[model samples]
Target: MSFNGNESSAISLAVATEMTSDYRTNNPNETKAHFFGKNKLMDILNQNGCVGIRAYYGIDADGNKQLVFVGADADEKDLYSGVILDMSAPCPSNCDNTSPLNG
Candidate 1:
């Protein structure tokens, strides 16, 4: 589902946490080097604290706009090396990306 700036921010945090935990559990081999590879995404995640900073532009299965999840961390290296997650949900008929916070 489409999310406004604020809603997107909230969802980003949730998704980042989920992804981080998943990585720690499922991909223990992951290291700081792997997380901080993407500079831009890592910067945004650091400033926003677990917010899902979109890495690429694309659409979901239902044709709804989707954003890539940027993992959480402070150091650019740490941030990029973290796991990426997906936070797409089906949009309701009345969904409004302009004001997703209302949802």
Candidate 2:
């Protein structure tokens, strides 16, 4: 199996909302979402040999939830030496209240 950077990762709004709602119900104090800037995301995607990306669940020194992103190669291996990204603006601090996914 190989990646050509053509994977379908879409989900219906209803499903997304339900999942987020469940998460909030369980972890009411946790971050509702994480916002990674487009430029940083594009940088990871544009790295040489990067066919996709993988997000790892993380916790910062402050014990806040975060995500660590790294480029993935065609074989689904992490490009550890490439441009890894973090420092997302997490929700509760930066969120769109109007978005259904945030509720």
Best TM-score among the predictions, by candidate number: 2
| Model 2 regions more than 4 Å off | none
Error of 1 at 39 (Å): 25
Runs of candidate 1 with Cα error greater than 4 angstroms are 1-57, 77-81, 93-103
Residue-by-residue lDDT tens digits, candidate 2, 1-103: 8878886688999999999999999999889889998999999999989988899999999999899999999888899998988889989889999998887
On lDDT, the leading prediction is 2
TM-score of 1: 0.28
Which ten contiguous residues of candidate 2 have the minimum total lDDT?
Answer: 1-10
Q: What TM-score goes with each of the models?
A: 0.28, 0.93
Query: How many steric overlaps are in each model, in order?
Result: 8, 0
Model 1, residue 71: distance off in Å is 1.5
Candidate 1 lDDT, tens digit per residue, 1-97? 3323343334575666566556557744432111223555444555544534545555668664555665543232224555554444323333344
